[model samples]
Target: MIILCEGKHDYEFIKELISKINVKCDVKDQGPRDKDFIIGHVVDGKRLSYVPIIIEGGKDRLDGNVRLLISKLRSVHGSSTWVLILRDSDSNDADSAFDKLRRDIVSLINNPSKFLLYKPSMDCGQGIRVGSFVYYDCDLKYMDGVVHFRFIFVVPSLEVFLRNYEYVNDDSRLHYAIDKALSDPGIVMQ
Candidate 1:
């Protein structure tokens, strides 16, 4: 599984969330451009690895980054990879944000016929809203086999999401959120 998220804050939040779940993982700083997060856990005594890539350039670069990452993964892992894209909806509505992302992916792969678009369902808690869309058996051009794509959109941005959980304040500083999560592990459950 490969997780693609926007910015360092998203990466940190995910890293902290995985830690809160007691999942053992290794994170490597791939320098200022991006971070390589390899989340490993033992299941049935077997270890599994999930790689997460952070796109510091934000949403505008998502399509290009997705193409680049998928191309690289195809060479090593072949078509047997699951991609999860995490982005903030920002000012856009959930549906609009999802549509824009869907369009971007469709354009990226140039396989609209094999792309199955589904309306993302919204989940809300304490004024915090998020949505997700899953594309199963999606075909990527130049890749031999099918791939699965999942897009998760956090409404009004991840900062708001963290704020609702009391993990960050109005400013939503990276250290502030990390400190809150470190202090209250139960925040993950909420």
Candidate 2:
């Protein structure tokens, strides 16, 4: 299932989950910009993509859009599609929002469990206050049967993850190679 979110931070965070947990899943960082316009398409025999964004000021962020997306899934895919909205559960209307979403989308889905909205953030921080785990937070932790261990390696924040982890850090060479680049003036000048 392609885990879609609002922005890049979420994308990086999800990537961290995939890497840290080794879930072997594809997560498409479909920004809010591309979500509303997306309707439905059966990419392969297994994948079904739909655009379901229902926040504030969003074009397709309503009951109608939920129903529409589900309808498209049912008609085009001819099977149940998992449209999991991993949205932020914050502010006053958080749980209420999910309730409204479930109430609207339930009728359209073959299985209600297939459609869901969950907050994957740590400690359940809400509204705009999202305490998302950085790649550093994930580090690398393996299991040992029933118990667990930690080898806390500081992996930096979301921006650092994008830059260092994914090699999207053309902006800060100093961060990319602070010590070595600093040691060589030419590298800094370059």
State each model's CA lDDT, in order.
Answer: 0.51, 0.33
Write model 2 residue lDDT over 4-86, tens digit each, in one string.
34334434444544444445544444543454344334323343332232232331343354345444333222332334333
Q: Where does candidate 2 have its weakest 10-residue lDDT segment?
A: 144-153
Error of 2 at 165 (Å): 19
Residue 145 lDDT (model 1) = 37
Regions more than 4 Å wrong, model 2: 23-26, 31-44, 47-65, 76-80, 92-94, 106-190
Q: What C-alpha lDDT does candidate 2 achieve relative to the native structure?
A: 0.33
Encode model 1's per-residue lDDT on 1-190: one tens digit a residue. 5567777777776677666665666643233244222221211122244444554457767656665554343332233445666677776576676666556654544544433342122222222332322222343433243345566666678777566446545544665766574566443332
* Decoy 1 TM-score against native: 0.58
Q: Which candidate number maximizes TM-score?
A: 1
Record all residue pairs in model 1 with backbone atoms less than 3 Å apart, i.e. clashing.
none
Backbone clash numbers for all candidates listed: 0, 2
